[model samples]
Target: MSHLVSNAATDKISPTLPLTTDQKRLVDQILAFTTAHVNETGPAVFTVYGDAGTGKSVILAHLFNQLQTASRTRPDSPLAKTTNYFLVNHPEILKVYREIAGKEPHLLKKDFQRPTSLINQLAKGITTADVLVIDEAHLLLSQPDHYNNFYGENQLSSLLAAAKVIILVFDETQVLRMKSFWTEKRLEHLLAHYPHQHVRLTHQFRMQASDELVAWINDFTHSQVRPLPQSVGAQYDLRIFNDAEQMRRAIVTKNNQVGLSRVVSTSGYPSTLDGGKHYITEGHFHLPWDQYNYTSTPWAELPQTIDEVGSIYTCQGFDLNYVGLILGPPLTLSPQNQLEVHLDRYTDVEAFKRRADITDAQELTAIKKQLILNSVNVLMKRGVKGLYIYAHDAHLRQYLGAKAH
Candidate 1:
């Protein structure tokens, strides 16, 4: 919950800078769409989709702040008195809201039997609000049956009913877990209910111009966006180290040169292999936010910067000058002898039982090829400058070799 600015340069970039051309275009479109709906006095929804690290969250944050500011300036404006809820993955936003409001926002306690009712009450308090911006919209649109049976009768229905204008920010390409709520079909369905406006964020300024990670992601997503070919001198700087020791040595050496860089594994925890170390986790490795209690061996406290043990999940909303990715398991070979992997497609029953190891025969059998394709698409598309892939599995190596060579 602590906010630390790693570098001074980041601080210079305020949260509400003048919108870039892309941002301006999206905002103008959104405003026009919302105005039309508001004129009709009907509810309207706007869905924004982009690949991870494409600055969807940043855009949303900017939009939210802009709308709130506009509302304050014109109390009688149709968009005045807007209600905004920035739902955090672990209710972290609750604290943030409390800080922003300068008062204690309602905190859902363990005994709160009907959380939805609480949300409804909160919505009622801001009934006059003109807009409600929801960041992490993917979480709400998840399947009703996934995870602790928390989703019921469409999670966004209550919020939708209360708000005149709703803005949802999310990326369809980053669903790492099978919580039923995070499916493409579900997203499509949710937006189908309303005459929603859809915007796709395409430009990625996070990484250097030479980086093709975004292009690779777009290709993986079956998007029209193409990676810069090697002919364009746009090669990803990814390399596979021989082993963990070699990787460690390289990191140590690189740290001296760059002051400090991050070493991330696709796995959440460290794993031991014959020739390398693996870290596997239920979530993606890179994330913009830091994980609580994550630490490295011989270091009592976890590194403050996410650049230390960067995972895709934690590093999704973040960017770096260089990214080193350590690929993890659930690897296999396709009929065409291509690399096939389905990281989140484990067997339903075993995953329900919370099995630590993904070794159940049923789980492996249920693995979906599409999920494997999606995983590879997400994993390979994370670098800005270079990609260093160390494939311990020979089958995977062969498949990658076919593609890279």
Candidate 2:
């Protein structure tokens, strides 16, 4: 069941070691640009755009390492004595970054912060940063969110005003919330006015699957349901299972054999913040949704997570050896045989909050559906070696099973 998925921490952000050749080139290019433009009068932005697993964060990690190295130890370097900070919105990913920083010689835990924290500090005149790097910039809030203590009109705009230079990673298809909703067109419009440079990373660096299989995944997430590829996985371990219980057993076996394998699900089952376990049950397969991991280790790295069903929030931007993915109640095969999202059946209410900028009823509904599908994209792309799926809709399962065999 194993493919050529590297066990080395390449896809995962590496603070101490640089990744592949492409990543190294990007790091060098971006660092050179940052060095030359750090003294510019106006804000400058360098954007890295790519789908999940295109080494976006990998290059950023290396870029930050170089920045810190030059600014701290090398007085002759252009970036010397410059203040820089890295920001990420996801708490889980932020935790991983901080953990990695603590182990690296040139980086410190204080160098990383949640986007909100940095913004608040800068606003208070408590901190000044010359260069800022943001991971998951797509998750930056476009509207004021009082709950997270962000009172700014837009996180990205505010950050641009506060810093002299900015570098960010953005994937529009990975946006899963209304508050952080973005499109390539919207992003382009915002950057048109700023001094911005962009590079679109087109190659797949994470999933060991073929280009045909990757295209199929993209089609499915775009609501185009077609027959499963003639080959289920070929070199990869992609497969469709009729029963969730069977898939769970297979994933557990994979985890026991390889490590870093788990069962994850798309929105459908109960999700809450009440400090309790809400189980996702399919036939005889029943497991609690991922609990809040308070420890320093990431959720997928924890030994106990194999017994829990992972959500997008827990699995995004992380690699897995194998993934047993449950396509929950919200996803189904339509009469036209197209993949569809049933918003009414989706259980994640927090992702459906109203956005003031989106007023058209039809437009809002369409955006919400895309957000739901965005979570699916994040979950399916996690497995480095394989992806095992079970659909709740009987017709969808049967349709996929027809081709899986």
Candidate 3:
């Protein structure tokens, strides 16, 4: 396959790959559960919970592939003649799955769809769902969003009503918007009403970074700051650059040597819904945010995408050889070298839209900060081989550079 057809990011989650031991066990359990409850009156749910880079996507991909194969090709199998669909909220990831469908015999492009599309289809009575496998279920809209044309109160709730079996992956930390806000407690309560089983995959499968380095990134996302782990420099190419220009240069070099490397950032720069470019500028470093991808190919896979800066929307659920992260203006270091979120500086207004459920000022503000940190968490885990950093705040950049020994 050509580089555009497959690369590190797409290959990591390819459906054709063999599953790991844990993944295989989970798949077996889900399949057994479906066999036992597919004909039951209530929906049978097999939820998979894992943080980013824990191989949730690939496992689901493999599981769905098996389901489709059994349903379409196996004559004597109990799952034969069953209908199944693979759903994901992320458009970029949906593109990858659709592309992969073209190369596989049992997988069909029509089998992959966005959650909103499926929900609307079921509501319109155009098609009925049987088994639905949803990836990144945390991104599902819990509120009625007419902007995306979803009029349902909760997406998963509708899927449960429509499908006999539902399988999904969830990561509370990956929740980005108010419309899709979810907590562990919320998920547990929802699952309580259905016949459900869950498994949590804690293994680190994406980043080549050391355990200490991974823990450090996790702590940072939780708004905790600590001295950099000594294993960073030697164990991974975790570098903190004083200049965004230099970091961009490093990322470009890595991209030339190994494709899938790009510069990404948090949401603190100038951005709007206008169709024009919104450039992110920092001392001699300037690049526009990733444009709306209209083509079937993913943005990160496009050859010219190296010139653009990726945001959480485009780069989530992706893998890179190296990622040069420009810490946007919303993030800064305090007097004690701790990270702080400057909500006033955040430009992504869509992420902080008013929610009828939230009224307390302090609670709303805290959630906004968590959303900012969650974006950072998504970017930090993208790189498979290395992670490069540059902060817009001078003091924050200096502190990161000094601690990145």
Candidate 4:
């Protein structure tokens, strides 16, 4: 198979194409809604929700580029008349946009200390933009405090007051990140309060039909109360090699069959076991500069250092054809022999404590269970054909048992 080259170099990072059949229908609906609203005298807000890695960002990028192009050529066109604004939480998105736009736009630095200033700054930008697209809207509404801080005195009101069209892209399922305020109820409240045209992106194009990981995630999120079959399950094909040598050999073999342009997800750091070096496949890895620090280098320069043992928060909006998750020390079983799960991603301590099994809840133990479940969900969903598990802990193996198959 031939690899398609992207117009922009950044597209090589994780390039994806347009939506599939079902997704196209949904996109058409969204476009129709936007067109209708653009024609109206009043402002309008459009919301799009979907599962993680379901092409929300891709769609947003496509829309941005298309609108920008249309505006450039047909200055009188409805889309052309609209000034586009893309709001995102990740700095990476800004970097990608900068690369795409080939220039820097006016930057409004956020002031975290003086919360009111942040809202004011965000509100101030709306007047210049005819259309505003806020990606990862889930994060904006996940926290009450941040919600108040960002939207205090009706910040959305201010934005709507200025912009002719406001589009929000959110995924309730991907609300695992820290400082996120995503929830089904919160989204509903937003729609009700704001009176926006809401649409859901449900057709998953990232994972293939053979991926069982999707079913696991659905079950896990909806509570393990539902019956899920492996036939229609969303899972990945995972393989465990004895060491890095075997992993390297496997990756080389796969890439040879496919192409050199393939990518693999791995932890961003190196691990030394005894005297041997264990390197993760592809992508750069980085050792933490400081144990308490939360920064790392990009995966390209040090592909071996990319930490695959990331939380659900870090893994959002990313998809892997094949995920090789390394189980670190933090995810090992304790002396008590219980599955201690961590809920630190959750802001509500009481809710976390209540859900966690306190009987054997050591830091490592809790981390282990959470990692296992999360890794199982993440790693399994990553592959279209299979899933691989390399559990250093024997107890975890026993727990996974037949399910690992």
Candidate 5:
């Protein structure tokens, strides 16, 4: 509950303490480049790309620690004084970092802000920090509309203009909205005019599962038609249950046994708590999503949230010991024997809002489907020890059970 007093508080961001080999290599490279950039006034750009559990944030934290140490050793180092870190997406994630840092729970207000906030500051000539380190860069909006978007322009250019040394931690698959469509091609094109380095971190560090299990998870969520490898089946605790109550009970048991276990589901089911309905119900199983005002603690960390479900917005960019995932109404099996997504079933107004005018229904449908699939991918991969699934559609459940088993 203590607040960190300084932005350079590395201890708070040290959750997955030891960096994997891939992460360490990237951090070392960034540290060396940052040192040179500071001494010579050289402009530099670098991107660290990875999937959900690939330690992108971990590498950024390590880089921050290394830079902080260098600044301490060289008291006159400009990089130490000029560098700034920003977590653009997930306030809960910012809280987790603060908790890890163990000091700056209060100072996070200054340390963490949305990408748009940084742009607004730059436009107003608020601060002159040169090095900008961005976590959850995929959430950066290309065309800002709502969410307090003061710049009303592309965030990419605004960020680049704000800092000489640009370090972005990105995961392309986590792009949840249409306005936030930042792609590799666009990234490459932008950096082509500047000196930039692109590096990949592929090591699986968060999920305490094997490489095979990770691959299987990736394939399953993306709707890739691949048989679940027997080795992965044996090593990872993946289960498909037809009954949602059974899955919920198992998840509760898992939480009591090991902690850090919670239930998460798609927003396909409507949240009726505001309408005097305490729980979301289907057949005999029902649970409520975390209260909209549940802001004191991160959803996955709190013991009470185990009774409330989490969605992609609540669980992304964080890891858990176990996850009970419910595949809601949006996802189903088509007559062609393929995975189909129903956009109407999804009730996340912000996610499906037409930020840009698109007249074509087909185009809108395709985009919505991709967003749903991405959400499913994120929710399913939150577990470190195991994943328990309950598919709402009977056919999809049968299909998943057959393939996963």
Candidate 6:
């Protein structure tokens, strides 16, 4: 496959953050493999597997910059024959990358494309770089391209066919929708055909919370009950609010004092609740979920958006100073004192598009419930400094409050 020269030209070849030691080692290994692939005309696949906040994106960005520089400075080197591009599924993240390009005009030639756009281009015979780096690849469809309306069995197959070097940053637990979800077996099936290397990242860099707090979060979200460490709660600024109104006020105070804090929640209420004006309400607590069309707007960045709220979709790939998460109807505590997920109560219908095909209602319900729990896990871990939560369910709220104290 020839390198997509246009994408390489359009890529903003700069590293935004420094890679940690483990990240640096992975990049070095990838580059070394890519160099060999370029020389021998063979194919290679690389996977960076990690949970949220492992710095996977930072490593990819840094590697892209290094490759771009080598291709320019050493025209006769193996890197010269290879071109690269960055692909993201989220429009908000694409907007952020474009804004970064604006600051560094030289990166304007580097391409940052949405998966659907790139797939369409490829279908039309437009090659997009020999080296394709995909971030948030867990969102890629494992089944046929039904959502994109393309002529392909799946994205992974098409990507392998189009690129000489394919780098996928995947977090299986982050899968938000059923249509695009991939299992480990599916991922392994794809890797079986290519020479591949897998690297797993474990460090948590996004949140400033202690290790014990992080562990508690993981356990709670996974349905593994564990007592919250008193020291951990004291160290981190975690608060459970019975009243969503008070939580909102606290978020505002944090925003005014520190900055980069906002309210986010599960789509338990209708997406167009209150005509999409005031979608969230409970005893004087009124807030709206993120606007559906703000995909192009960096909702989390703009200073004027303090009043606006976001859901898992909008704030998934970004970090924040403080996060006020509304644990709406989708999450609750069962009479047995166990965490329960009410999939039917969740309002994110678009994500549950394949529900009609589920023959086994029990299994389908379990999957839906897990997806909701995964969304909550993602939201809770977004804050770099603190996580403030307001559960709509009284029992769940009380339970969380007890844990916090």
- Write the residue-wise lDDT of candidate 6 on 1-405 in tens digits: 111111111131237554557777888998997787755444588888988877777787777666766765677778884667778888777786766656553355347787767777877887656777888898876565554675566677777777778888998778888877666667888789788888888888767677888888888778764555565534358888877888888988988877778899987886852344646787888766667545455677666667767888878877777899988897788767788778778888767767334569888777777788789888988887789988888887777653322
Off by over 4 Å in 1: 1-14, 35-41, 88-130, 144-151, 183-185, 209-213, 217-236, 249-260, 267-312, 333-336, 342-376, 398-405
Q: Which structure is stronger by lDDT: 1 or 2?
A: 2
Q: Evaluate residue 11 in candidate 2 and report its C-alpha lDDT on the 0 to 100 scale.
A: 33
Candidate 3 clashing pairs?
none
Candidate 2 vs candidate 6: which has greater TM-score? 2
- Residues 105-199, candidate 2: write the lDDT tens digits: 88989999999999999999999889999998999998888999999888999998888899999999999998888888887888788778889
Error of 1 at 327 (Å): 1.5
| Candidate 5, superposed: residue stretches over 4 Å from native | 1-16, 38-43, 76-80, 104-109, 233-235, 272-278, 355-364, 402-405
* Lowest lDDT 10-residue stretch of candidate 1: 104-113
lDDT by residue (tens digit), candidate 5, 94-153? 666655544422233365556766677778888655666788888877776665554466
Worst 10 residues of 4 by lDDT: 104-113
- Computed on alpha carbons, the lDDT of every model, listed in order, comes to 0.48, 0.85, 0.86, 0.46, 0.70, 0.74
Clashes of 5: 10
TM-score of each: 0.67, 0.95, 0.96, 0.63, 0.87, 0.89
Order the candidate numbers by TM-score, best to worst.
3, 2, 6, 5, 1, 4
Off by over 4 Å in 3: 1-8, 233-235, 402-405
Q: Candidate 5 lDDT (Cα, whole model)? A: 0.70
Model 1 gets an lDDT of 0.48
Q: Any runs in candidate 2 off by more than 4 Å, and if so which?
A: 1-11, 16-18, 232-234, 402-405
lDDT of 3 by residue, 352-387 (tens): 767898899999988888988988999999988899
